[model samples]
Target: MANLSLDSDELLLPRDVVAVDVPASWGGEVSHQLTFAGPLGPILALPGRRTRWLFLARWDTRPHTPPPDVRYWRDRVPAPTAHWVVRPGDALPLVSVIRCAIRTVRP
Candidate 1:
């Protein structure tokens, strides 16, 4: 099992969500099993590849706090809360996708 932290300033706001594109193989298996961890606890497991967009957000408990939302590639999607880790699995490599996305964002 892998552990991810969601206590970063970048994820403090409700709208601060990260969108990760999870690619699947022809067999419908993913290269990794992701686990998201928030300040409270584990948010949710990777929902099967219904949508290529893996939306992520930070867990907020403020009253009436709006949910996390993102606009990627001209599409808007709701995001789940927290940090994530990629576990070993069979299929396409998702870590590379995530790393690439992060790299594009920072510097």
Candidate 2:
């Protein structure tokens, strides 16, 4: 489990609640992993892919604090690999974030 510590009012989403779906081919199955960070949400990565996606959850309610910005994510997420944030819901944001991350990393 993640060593994430949250305040009493903050939402600590379960593995299922924040789960993200990715291409099966990327890892032989669609799996989710939580990246321990601030309010930036979960991180998704594939072994061969040069880019990773940072998913943003709605928290199902208003949070005591606002979510972190992209700069915060870029600075904290792992280096060498590119990262992008994907807001919860439909496939559009997922695809768009993937494309954007690819574009940013491909040079």
Candidate 3:
């Protein structure tokens, strides 16, 4: 993926959520991580392949809390998915929205 350049209309400050459109056959390893600031802290996404374009979700990490049940989301979210391990706080709603968007497109 390349830089996410956005037009004036697409720009959203603070929670600057951007979408990177990638081909379906992309299998290259995610050598670099693109992170954005969420409500809590830094949020990162590793996009995975889907039927057409790739999809991404903000994953939060909680050191004190038990690890998230990623196994369940792995299948549903698709391959090459990006996750941001963060404290369970404001990121929850963003993650939920990302998951819901992914679910809507999946078969």
Candidate 4:
């Protein structure tokens, strides 16, 4: 929703990963995207509700390739953040950690 400030600690280097804490109401799984224009410049998205989210960290594969973790979010998950780094030879799409919850909490 806003520009992702890239600090020294949050620097997304090559082959690294970061997770974004999305809200349950968002109904993730529609592949949400986190993009960086330049050095924490302009972060953009479709600006609409989605059914999914993606994790760019595990670019090689999704759902199965990466650990079972990044696929979903914890109930007390943190806030969403963007990550970017230079890939030596391949291209990896932006990724976002989709939030999920147990049906017991449904209103």
Candidate 5:
């Protein structure tokens, strides 16, 4: 597992999971991108607004290669990957997303 420190919270993520800054064009309002080297593919997390943040997960059987310059491989990527919008002040949804990513990793 990898230790990811966000503010005062530290998240244990899969060792192959990597987070990078998301470009304004692709991220829209998000701050970072989480790329899993597994079937889970990429999971984009938007910055928290006054009430909530968004978590977008994409499933792909093929390996994920992060686009150069923080751009997505294709513009249409977001359309099909718009999977979930976590409710305000809810950490459970985020946990679930993390779990899914973790599960995709192979020992």
Candidate 6:
């Protein structure tokens, strides 16, 4: 959903592909701070293909420290709070696009 307007300008080409620039040559999670102008909240990318990234934190900036939330990402944990899957890409924009599409259809 996004605009479906193929304007090319609406394209979600992020500033970087992998989210964060780090020293992990082996390829790994990188945190990207996306301050959505709307209220969708901040996205933490444990990078992956498709909808792999989950909601890491709300817009409040209070760390998501719940054991369940942390456990879901325990397979790989680091200070960056971002993980990767398949390759590094922006996942939040994808989610936002989907949400926008759904809203258009539902409303």
TM accuracy, model 6: 0.19
Across residues 12-82, which tens digit of lDDT does each residue of candidate 1 receive?
22243333333322112322222221111122233343433343333233433222232221123333432
Candidate 4: tens digits of C-alpha lDDT, residues 29-106: 222222222122121121225422222222233443322222332222222442322222243333422222212222
Best by TM-score: 5
CA shift of 73, model 4, Å: 11
Location of the lowest summed lDDT over 10 successive residues in candidate 2: 27-36
Backbone clashes (count) for model 4: 11
Write the residue-wise lDDT of candidate 5 on 1-107 in tens digits: 11322322232233333333243344322322223322232333433322222233322334444434432222122222222232222121232333333333311
Q: Measured by TM-score, how close is model 3 to the native structure? A: 0.21
Per-residue lDDT tens digits for candidate 3, residues 1-79, read 1222223323121233322233333212211112222333223344433322322334444322211222223213222
Q: Rate the local accuracy (lDDT) of all candidates.
A: 0.29, 0.30, 0.30, 0.28, 0.31, 0.27
lDDT of 6: 0.27
State which candidate, 4 or 5, has the greater lDDT: 5
- Give the per-residue lDDT digits (tens) of candidate 6, residues 1-107: 12111122221222221122122321122222232323232233433232234332212222333221122222223333343232322223333332332233333
**What is the descending lDDT order?**
5, 2, 3, 1, 4, 6
Candidate 2 contains a number of clashing pairs equal to: 0
TM-score head-to-head 2 vs 5, winner: 5
Model 2: per-residue lDDT, tens digit, 1-107? 24322233232333323322333233211112221122234344422353333343322322232222222121123333322332323322232333233234332
Where model 4 places Cα greater than 4 Å from the true spot, the runs are: 1-15, 29-92, 95-107
Pairwise TM-score winner, candidates 3 and 6: 3
Give the range where candidate 5 is weakest over 10 consecutive residues by summed lDDT. 83-92
Model 6, backbone clash pairs (residues 3+ apart or across chains), number? 6
Cα deviation at 7, candidate 4, in Å, is 27
RMSD to true structure for each model, in Å: 13.2, 14.9, 14.1, 14.1, 13.1, 14.7
lDDT of 5: 0.31
